[model samples]
Target: MSIKINTYITILMLSSAAFISPLITKGQSTSLDSSQPETVVQKKYGLDPSKPLAKRIGNTPPEIIQKFRDAGMSPTLHRLSKTDSLKVVRAFQMLPPLHQHILKEHLLGISFLDNMPNTALTATVNPEDQFPVFTITFRAEILKQDVSQWLTEKEMSYFTKDFPGFRIAIEAGKLDAILYVLLHEATHVVDGSLGILAMDQNKGTSGMAVNLKSFTRNIWVDRTSICPSYTDSLTSQSRFRGGGRLLPMELARQIYQSAAKGPFVSLYATSSWHEDLAEYLTVTHFTKRLKQPFRIIIHEGRKEIFIYEPMKSATVSSRISLMKYFYAKAGSSVLYERHVKPGGRGFNG
Candidate 1:
């Protein structure tokens, strides 16, 4: 991802138009990390911003395959089959208008990678550029599973090993995995667009002050670290926060107890403020608007040891009211499924 070339394209096409004639709801999707430098991920995978969303669905880029090697994982590019492609497109269509609007405006393209353990989006960020454009890369297998199966697999990555009688499960029912992932990634888009997390902003440059966003105010000290009041040494040692080894299953109960007391929704949310925003929005929407369950079952041998449902926490509820910032511009109710459009337009984020 050459910041030079893409900056030219984005500045001329996207930034110029968006700023000159701003869209009703605006922003970019995904976090920053240019996957391949040979050519932009959008062009290599046949992504044309001029095309409609459905037409944009196609093969994964080779750069995505190479990116897995950085993590020592060998993943192949998996083009979407006709049936899978429809499911992917449908998932995008189901999203709220704010989400739809953000992706439609700045998404260069989206693709899949086989053998990839998780879903991710990469961006080429130039602080001078207001709207940082991005492309999404998903793990191809997600197309086959519902939200529960997908989330359970993802949530289990926190632990060292998964053995019988000592396991964790996410009983989130049958919401489509693609829908959940897209919504989750889209929140990152909102973060990038609204400067919600400030990770890609010019704050890191010397003499530049870090002013935390309203969403991150008391929770995060900076993009990578949380406030001391919210930080606990135990959860800090969990896999996601630079802890080398995974945690033991025996500590699941203690983990949930500490997490429930914090502003965080999940252990993974503790990874950073960027992911914190993503996980927060994803869980709230999944359980509230979608009317689904998000339960974490930690089992010890044959017995259920601890169950932590984020939706019920007082700390979690505090964040829900703040989510209105995502859609409040249109004066729509916070976290509601029926996204009202600007003035009187139809729901189309």
Candidate 2:
């Protein structure tokens, strides 16, 4: 896949140029059971690794921040104001209960920094468990953006250089960027926790194994390569796929046209099956739940050249069946978005 991968302390982070940096403190939390012995119980409040993220928000430790800098990521840690921290709360609330449930069970906390190279990434909190605790870091700038701007900006980065007079616009609505990004990054957590992307081998589960064949089985033979039938010569070499050079804007029409016929929801979804699930679910949610139109408007000097709407394809609709797992509703709202009735089974959770 063209995207970067970093595996640190068992499992780390995944984003555009993904990194799994060591972004935790030296301290670890232990169970309250008297059966276990401990010397000193040191807690750093919001920074404590023992507590799964509750309400408090905090920054990464100074040393961990330096590690990210050394790895060529955001070098400056951004201290959050009270209003900024509330933004995170609002974003977390916007998530489907299932997404929040998965993160609360395994995620440690979220971090923020200025000038981040990626939208978001996950790091280890307690790496010893089969399911390690996670911490996700965000580009502090998300607080200043809306979903439309963030989605458009992130989508634009796939191409190498900009098109002189042409620009691609992702016409999603004006929701908060934190909600959009947090949804995408947290879905990775769901995939890592549940086996939605059964293709991933890094989720910390020790026993609750999922069915081997995933939603990606027919579409992707492996994490990176698409099935022969789905791979178009034009779209396969996308700059997002480790292609030798960045393609020009003129090529976008053909690339997206080829992708619309395929099962993927967006061009970036073609990066990896892991990304496929993330993009597919998030983009679909952006459209269906929020009732926003995910239109890729290519404008040439204020005149529209081409407009690509990804949802109209029959291929994407066929895959909507796979989405039942994400929407299965139950009293366990915290767990399943929707419940599968008899005769119909959802993602083999």
Count the clashes in each prediction. 6, 9
Model 2 TM-score, 2 decimals: 0.76
Stretches > 4 Å off in candidate 1: 1-50, 61-63, 69-74, 125-129, 162-164, 199-213, 328-349
Model 2 ranges with Cα > 4 A deviation: 1-54, 61-64, 72-74, 160-162, 199-214, 330-349
Which lDDT value does model 1 have at 127?
25
TM-score of each: 0.73, 0.76
Question: Per-residue lDDT of 244-314 in model 1, one digit per residue for the tens?
Answer: 44666677778788888888887778876667767888888777777889899887777887898888988
TM-score of 1: 0.73
Worst 10 residues of 1 by lDDT: 12-21
